[model samples]
Target chain A: MLTPLFEAVRPIPAIALVPVAILLFPADEQGIVFITFAAAFFPIMVSTRHAVRALPTLWEDAVRTLGGGRRHVLWHVVLPGILPGVFGGLSVGMGVSWICVISAEMISGELGVGYRTWMSYTIVDYPAVIVGMLTIGLLGWLTSAAVELAGRRVTRWLPRAEEAS
Target chain B: MTLGITLESLSLGYARGPVLNGIDLTIRPGEVLVIVGASGSGKSTLLRALAGLLPAHGGRALAGDEEITGASRERAMVFQDDGLLPWRTVRRNVELPLRLRGLPRGERKAVAREWLARVGLEGHEDRLPRELSGGMRQRVQLARALAGAPRAVLMDEPFGALDAQTRAGMQALLLDVLRDTRATVVFVTHDVDEALLLADRVVVLGHGGIRTIVDVPGPRDPAADRTALRAQILEEL
Candidate 1:
């Protein structure tokens, strides 16, 4: 039911929502957070939906025959089955969120990497700008790595085909 | 605690069209009834109706006194694909039905381990389904099905995907396990030899309904001469 609305709003880039976030929130900090969240939310939601739909009906039937009800199917089969796909989405979302957050900070912020980078640009401090850019890249890489590590830990039951060697 | 299954003119099909039309059969308590047919002959469809996974298109299917309106723990199904939860460990997969039944965690664990040992899958409980061989995975599926002590077991070519050697081993293991449980077994297979080896009564499904029902003279006897009987079943197919 929410697909239509989600589809309509998804195409509007999260970075472009800076003015709207500024108007909606009382502080720039809240606006920046909102923009970051918005950037992350769509990828996660779309991937999760696809994951749920792609699950085999056989699993649900197996659970049902074993006397499991709707709630049991949801918890046992659906949630765990979608973990790998959800993690894929989370990784993408983390990357996208970093881009949006940095952009939002540069557009409207008193402090942070994006602001510092923009400030260095105005003052012709080329080395400081390079440091800020490097910091942003580092932070983005770390967050994505964290998500992937968590994903592997949770879905450890998945067979690691390459590990056999 | 085994349950007798009666199909009173049961007609099964999908939204496209009917498969089996107005079929009447009685699967006795503790009896092994093997359904054999060519492809698209509705053997699996009939078993699904008994398992309550598929609704009867025109008639009713009864498990003991109650009508089989939907799936129940009393009738557990084992699929050709094993149907073990991919993300769960072997032990956890076997414990699923017990967990669904609200069994306490410790008791569920103990019972799961016992079932796994019975299927000769001990010491591999912590492994995932993907880590196991096809034969071992099928054993896990069997363990999971019987863990709850269901009154009836509906199998849809459970060993059909296995190689000949592994299939024979699984058949022997199944006979050994069936000796312990009195559950009525409705097994579907395309192999006439397998049907003869396991079935007390062989149900030949063809041309949209049951073609014939043959009673094996002596079931589960590997040394028994079954050439004539095999020929008769093949003729029906």
Candidate 2:
């Protein structure tokens, strides 16, 4: 859903929430973590649901006729069928969490990439802010790309996104 | 132990309307009844109704003396589409009916392998349905339907999709198996030749219902002179 797209880019949006969090949560790290968790939850849940709904009826019928009950079918068939979708959602959620964590730190309180970036900004040290942003970008990309790779390996049955396109 | 079918004004169809209207028919022990009709004429629907796969719109069906309105576990069906689960191996496909019946795993495996061998798929037990050829899949379906030792076997054009040569071979195999099992068979097909070759009595079903149940002469043989009989049935149609 729209949640995944927004959460994946949450770090960029977290900068904007700095003023509001500072007013609401008394300048603390707890508020920053709270914001980060909020940014990742929705996307993961929605994508997993979509994947679960898209499985073929033939799979269920085949299992049932082959002597599998409802529980066996759900776990063995439905779970594996939707694992790729769940991984996709999870990757988005993780990327967003890292982004929001850094942004929350730099703008609202002490700690995280956002906090250090803001400190550098106050001292007019453009290099430090640039370094923080570059570090966050590189780390986020590596983590998300790792997730995508793992997803592909797990779902070798699914066609590659580029090839399918 | 004789297999018999009794239907009292059985009506069958989907949500829209009845595919086969209220009609009475009986399949006696060791008898093969071929229900012939054109496509969409509810030939398959009638077969499915007999198998208890499709619910009746009206009336009832009894296998031997037990009613088929509920789960009878006495009837097995081979769908026209070969309804083999793509994920299952040939052996497992044959074992499915037994598994559904709640037999132990060891017994299921032994019986499944026995039936798979009977269908000439002994070495291909582990091969998935997708890996098998069309004829092979159809044979697997037959093995699955017959493995449970059902009282009646309903086949909806089991060989309808196969090549001519393969279809003929499958028909011969089926006749051989039927002779051994003596299971009451309700074979639905559009081919007059197939109906004539396999059925003890060929029922030519036109647009409305079964027009006539023609008592075929002598034991059916495809190589025999059935041309005159075919023409006679066509005239009746």
The top-ranked prediction according to DockQ is 1
What candidate 1 keeps of the native contacts, as a fraction, is: 0.83
Estimate, for each residue in A1-165, the C-alpha lDDT of model 2 and write its tens digit.
Answer: 585786566445554665666677884677787777676766677788899899775455444434456776686578877887899898988887787787677666677667788899899999998997898789889889998889877776554567556
Q: Lowest summed lDDT over 10 consecutive residues: which window, candidate 2 chain B?
A: B68-77
Show model 2 residue runs off by greater than 4 Å: A1-165, B70-72
lDDT of 1 by residue, B1-237 (tens): 999999898999999999999999999999999999999999888888888889888989999999999999999999997599998899999999999999999999999999999999999999999899999999999999999889999999999999999999999999999999979999999999999999999999999989999999874787899999999999999
Give residue B22's error in model 2 in angstroms: 2.1
Candidate 2, residues B20-88: lDDT per residue as tens digits? 766778888888998887777778777766665567888888888877754334666676774775545
By summed lDDT, the worst window of 10 consecutive residues in model 1 chain A runs over: A156-165
Worst 10 residues of 1 chain B by lDDT: B217-226
Q: Is the docking of candidate 1 incorrect, acceptable, medium or high quality?
A: high
